[model samples]
Target: MATKDADKKDTVLATAKERFEYALSRESENLERMKEDIRFAASSPDDPWQWDEATRKERKNNRPMLTINKLPQHIRQVTNDIRQNRPSIKYRPADDKADVETAEILMGLARHIEAHSDADVAYDTAADHQVTSGLGYIRVIADYISDESFDQDIYIKRVKNPFRVHMDPDIIDPAGSDAKWCFIDEDLKEDEFKAQYPDADPIDWQYASDAEWYPGDKQVRVVEYFEIVEKKTTLCLWANGETSFKDEERPESVMAVEKPLKERSVMKCECRWRKLNGQQILEGGDDGKVFPSRFIPVARVVGNEYEVDGKNYISGIVRNAKDSQRMYNIAQTAIVERVMQAPKSPWVAPAEAIEGYEKVWQTANTANHSFLPFNHKDEAGEPIPAPNRTAPATVETGLAQIAASASDDIKAETGQYDASLGQKSNETSGKAIMARQREGDNATYHYVDNLGRAVRHIGRIILDMIPAIYDTKRVARILGEDGEAANAILDPDHPEAFTEVRDENNEIKRIFNPNIGLYDVYTTTGPSYSTRRVEATEAMTAIAQGNPEMWQVAGDLMVKSMDWPGAEELAKRMRLMLPPQIQAEISKDEGGQPEQPQIPPEMQQRMMQVAEQMETMGNELQETKSDLQKAQQKAWQEEGKRIKAEIDADKANALLAIEKAQDSAAAANPAAGQGDVQEMVNQAVAMALANLMQQREPEPMPEPEPPMEMPQPEQPPMDGGMPMPESEVPQ
Candidate 1:
C-alpha cells in the first residue's frame, strides 16, 4: 500500500510537471517580450530611460542622463478616463426559462458582489497593467464568508503581477475564455513552505530549473494549476423536460420508474484546481476537487492581441511610443550637452586697454558695477579701445527642432496630442476642440474596450458559478443602477422563484434563483452614477432656463437628478405638487400604486348632496321624456282617425250622386234594360270618386317639439376638494 501510494504521488507530480512545462515552453517568447515591455514602461531607477549600459556608463562621468518620462502622463490620461467611466456588467435572459425580473436580480447581485469585493480596484489595476505592460488578469474565487461559516461567497480578485500567471498558448480568444489550463505561481521561503505543508517536499522541481520559476537557494516554488477535465456520462432527459446526469444522485421525482424521455451520451467538463510542487501534489490531488463552474476563473484583459504566422502577439499603448520616448530623451540630453559646452559671455580687448582696470574688468561678469574706468591709451600713448563684450554661443536651432519633433512623435505614437493632453491648441471653436479630443479617444478606445470584454467574461464566470455557490435559500443584498441597496430572498427550491414581494419601501422586491435560468452577460462602459447625475443636472438646468414652463411639469425630475443631500426628499415633495394625472404616471413608473385624493369632510358632504340632487333630476328628466313620447304617439293616432273620417264622407257623397244619375237614366229610356242603367250608374260613381280624390290633397302630420333640458346642480371643485357655496348651487 505504501509503494502504491508513492507511485500514485509520483504519477500526479509527473503529470503536473509535464503540464506546467508545456505551458511555460509555449509562453516563453511572449513572456520575455512582456517582461521587456514592463521594464520599459515602469522606467524604474535601474534603467528608467532605457539607456544603453555602455552609453550610461560613459555619461555617468559628467552628463545629465535625465529621464523625463512622458509616457506615464499619457498612460494616466487613458486610465483615469476609464476610471471616471467604469464598465458595468449586465445580464440578459437568453431563454424562455429566464425572466427579465430574474435577470435584473442577477445584475443587482453581481453589482453587490462587486461592491463588497471592491472590484473597482481589481478592474482598475488590470486596466493599468494592460495600458502599461500589454497584459492584465483578474480571477474569480470562492471563499467562506468567515472561518465559522459553511456558506461560500464568490469574489473577483486582482492579480497584481501579470508575470505570476501563465495561460494556455492555444487560446484564440482575446479574453482568454477559451483557455484550457492555467498556472499561478508563488515563491515561498524554505522554512515557510515546510511550516505550511510539512508532508510535502520542499525541493524545486527539475522541470522548474528556470531561475524565473524557482526563486534560488532559500525559496521553493508552488504552483496553483487549474485545468479542465472531461468525462463521458449518460444525460437523461426527463418527461418533465428536465435534464440530469444519470450518475448523479437526484430526488424521487427524477428517480421515478418512468422511463426517461430521452437519453444520450455527453461530455461533461469540470474545472479542477490543485496545489503542487516538484515532488507531489500538496492539495486537491487525485481526489479531484473541482470548481462549480466549468469555465476557468481567470480572465485576461489585453491591450491589443493578434496572431502572426500562428503565433500570438500582445502589445500595449507603450509599445509604439517607446521609440519616440527614446528619441525624446536623446534629444533632451543632446540639448543639455550643447548648453554645457557653450562658452559664457567674455570681454575682448588689447592687453594695454585693461592694464589699469584689470581688477574691475575681472569682476565685471560676476558683479553689478556702476562703471569701469579704463585707460584712455596704451603704454605707446595711442588711443586705447574699451573692452568689447562678446555674446555667448546658443544651442543649435537643429537640436531644438529635434527635441520638439521628438515630443510631437511621442504624442503622435500615444495618440494623445496637445488637445488631448489639455494643452492649448489653435482650435477656437468648441466643436473643433472636441473633435480633436475625440480623435485621441478613438485611438486609445481599444484598451478600454478590451477591458470591457474581460469584465464581461468575468461576469459570465461568476454567473456560471452562482447557481452552485449560492444554491441555498438566503437573503442577499442587491444594488440598483443608481447604487441603492435592497434585499432579495433567493429560494432555488421554490416553485415560483420569480414571484415578487413588497419591500420596506413598498417597492416590489423579486424572489430570485440564479440556478433557474439561462442568462447571458454583457458590459456597458459609461460615466459613473455620480458623474451621470452631474451631467443630468446640468442639462436639466439648461432646459429649465430655456423653457420655464417645462419646470412646472418636470421640476421633480430635475430635482431628483440632483446629487445634493436633500434632493430626493425635495423631489418627493415637488412630485406631490404636480398635476394628479402626471403624478399618477410618475408613481406608476416608480413601481408604486397611485394614491387616491383625500377629500375634507365638508367637501365630501357637499359632493354627496350634489350627487343626490343630480340623480333626482335625471330621474325626473327621464319621466318627462317618456310622457312627451306618449303624447306625440297619441296625437299621431288622432290625426289618422280624422283623415279616415274625411275619406268616408267623400265616398258617401259619391255614392249618392251615382244613385241619382241611375234613376234619371232609367226614367228617360223605358225601352232600355235595367242592366244598362246599372252600368251607367257604376261609371258615374267611379268618375265622381276620381274627381274628389284629385281635388283634395292629404296634409302632412306636425313634427313633435324637442324636450327642454333640466338644470343640473353645481359640482364641488376637485382642486383642494373645495365645496361650492349654498348660494351658488342651483335650487
Candidate 2:
C-alpha cells in the first residue's frame, strides 16, 4: 500500500511537470511570431542581416538618410487621445430600480478600487503600448500581506507589463479577457525567493548571475502559469423531517438522516510552476491545484477584433506610410537640398585673360570671402564678366508638392487633420468645425472602442473579485452628487441589520442596510466619453448662461465634465450657491422613492415649537374676538331700548297735543261741525309727526311699530252727545 501511494504521488508530480513543459514549448513558437510584431511596432523594422554596419559602409551615400518616420507619431497621437479621455468605470444596479444602498455600495467599492489601485497610470501605459505593438497586455492579481494587523487580507493590483508577458497567441481581450493558459516568467534574486518562501529549500537551486538581468549574483527564473482543471465536489443533502419524510416515518431512532452525496464537476485553477536554475528545476514545487480561476489573471488587449488567422494582426499607422515617408525623404534630400549643387555660368574668355581662375573657383565653392581672385586682363584687354545662373523653378515646386502630398497622405491614413488637431483652418462656422471633428472621430473610433472594451473588461474583473475580497465590512468613499465625497460601508456578506442609512444632512433614517456587491459594471461612452470635454463644456456653458434655468438643472454636470482647471472647486461652489431650502431638491436623485426631507433634529424641534406657539396665539385671538362681538351686541341692544323709550314718549306727547288742539279748536270755533273739526285735527297731527321725523336722527333699523295710537276724541258716538269723556272714549 505504501509503494502504491508513492507511485500515485510521483504520477501527479510528473503530470504537472509535463503540462508545464508542454505549455512552454507551445508558447515558444508563439513568442517568435510576437517578436516580429513587437519589432515592427517599435518602429525598428530593419532586417538585421541585410542592413548591418558592413552594408552601410559599402553604400557611400553623401546625403544623410531622411526617413520621415511618422508611424510612431500617429500611434502616439491616438494613444494619447485615449489616455487623455480616460473612461471612468461606472457602476449601476442590474435592475434600474434596485435598492439605492446596494447601488451606492457598489459605486463606493468602485471608487475605492480606483483610488487604491494604480489603474489609471496602468491604463495609459497599456493603451499606448498596445497601439504601438499591435497587442497590449495587463494583469490583475490579488495580493495579501501579513504583519501586525489583518491576515490574508486581499487587495487588487493592475499590472501593466506588455513586454515580458506570454499568453495564448489566439486570445484578444485585455479587459476582462480570458485565456486557456498564461505564463509570467521573470528572473529574481536568490534573496527574493528566500524572502517570499522562507519554508522552502533555498540552497537547492543553482545560481547564474551573468545570463539574467536581475540585480543579484544568484539569479533564478520564476515560471508561474495558470491552467484550467476540473475538480469533483460532493453535493450534500441534509434531511428535514417535515419535507423528506412522512409524519409516521419521522426519524425516532436517530436525530437526522444523511442521504447519499451527489457528485458534481467544478472548474478550478491548477496553478503550478517551478523555479529553474538554468536547465534544472529547484527542490520545491507547487503540488496542489488552486481552485476556481474563473479568469486568467493576464489580460490581452488587441488593436482590432479577435483575428482567427494570425496574418490579420493590426499593424501600426505607419505601415501604409512607409512608401510616403520614403517619397518624402527623396523629395527632401534630392530636391529640397539640391541648391548646394547649383550650376554656375562659365565665362568664356581668351586663355590670356584667364589667370588665377582655379583659386577663384575654389573660393566660390568653399569660402564666404569679401573678394574673389580673377584675371585682371585678357589677351584682347577687354574685361570678361562672371555670369550667374538660376536654379530651375520646377525643383522647388516639386519639393513643395511632394512634401504637401506626404502630409496629406499622413493625415488621411491616421485620421489626424488640421481640424482634429485644433490647428487653424478655413472652417468659418462652428458647425463646420464640428462636422470635420466628427469625421476625424469616426475614422479613429476603433481605437477608442477597443480601449473602452478593455476598460469594461477590467471593470468586470474587479467586480468579480469584489464580493470575495471585500466579504467583510469596509468604509469606502464615493464621489457623490455635486462632486462631494460620501462614505458607505462595503460589506456584501453582512445582513441588512447592520446598515445605517443617513439623509443628505447626515441624519440617520430608521431603516438601514449594508447590502453591497449586487451590481453591473459599465464603461463610460458616447461623444461625452471622448477627450473633447473642454469644447463641450464651453458650448454647454454658453447655452447654460443663455438659459439660467438650464444651468440650475445641469450646472453640476457641466462642472464635472468640464475637465478644466478648478472644475471640482467650481462644482462645489456652484452647489453651495443654491438656497438651503432647495438644495435638497436639486440634489434629489431620480431613482428610488425620494428620501423624506432630511430636516435637522434641532430645526425640526424648533419648527414644532413654533407651530405650537402659533396655535396658542390663534386660540387667544379667537377668544378675544368672541368677547368683543358679544360686548358690541349688548351695547346695541341697550341703545335700541333707549331709542324705543324715547320714541314712546314722543308719540305720547304728540297724541296729547292732538287731543288738546282738537278741544281748543272746538271751544274757539263753536259753530264748526264735528266732521270738519276731526279732519282738521288729523291733518295738524300728521304735519307735526312729519316735522318730528325730519328733526330726529335715523335709527340703525326702523324703530319697533309705536304701540300708542291717537285717542278718539269722544268720537261723537252714535248718540251724538257733546263728545264723550276723554277717559271713556276708547277705554
Question: Which of the numbered candidates is closest to the native, going by highest TM-score?
Answer: 1
Clashes of each: 0, 5
Could you tell me how far off, in angstroms, the CA of residue 57 lies in candidate 2 after the best superposition?
4.4
How does each model score on lDDT? 0.84, 0.57
The CA lDDT at 496 in model 1 is 52
Q: Per-residue lDDT tens digits of candidate 2, residues 1-731? A: 97986675556445545655665564564445455544544543243211235544653366333445555666777777776676666666664334656665555556556555666676777777566545566666665534664523223354455545656544544453656656566666778877876654433222323443334485556655565444444333234321222222433323545452333344433433334333333433334334223666555556643344553344445445555655655566557345645543233444543365666654554667676556665668877665333543345686878877987786887777778877768897999998998888788777677777777776766666665555565555565423356666555544442356667976653222333224677777543233366677888889988898876656776887776689879987766544444555654642233333334455455445555655666666668767767776788789889998989988898998799879877887889999988888898789878878888876675334333332322222221113334354232
lDDT of 2 at 445: 73
- Compare the candidates by lDDT and give the number of the best one: 1
Q: Distance from true position, residue 154, model 1, in Å? A: 1.0
The global Cα lDDT (0 to 1) of model 1 is: 0.84
Q: What are the TM-scores, per candidate, against the unseen true structure?
A: 0.76, 0.61
Give me the runs in candidate 1 sitting further than 4 Å from their true place: 44-47, 205-217, 249-255, 343-391, 501-509, 546-553, 582-592, 598-731
lDDT of 2: 0.57
Tell me the TM-score of model 2.
0.61
* Residue pairs clashing, model 1: none
* Per-residue lDDT of model 1, residues 371-402, tens digit only: 97778786678898777878766778887788
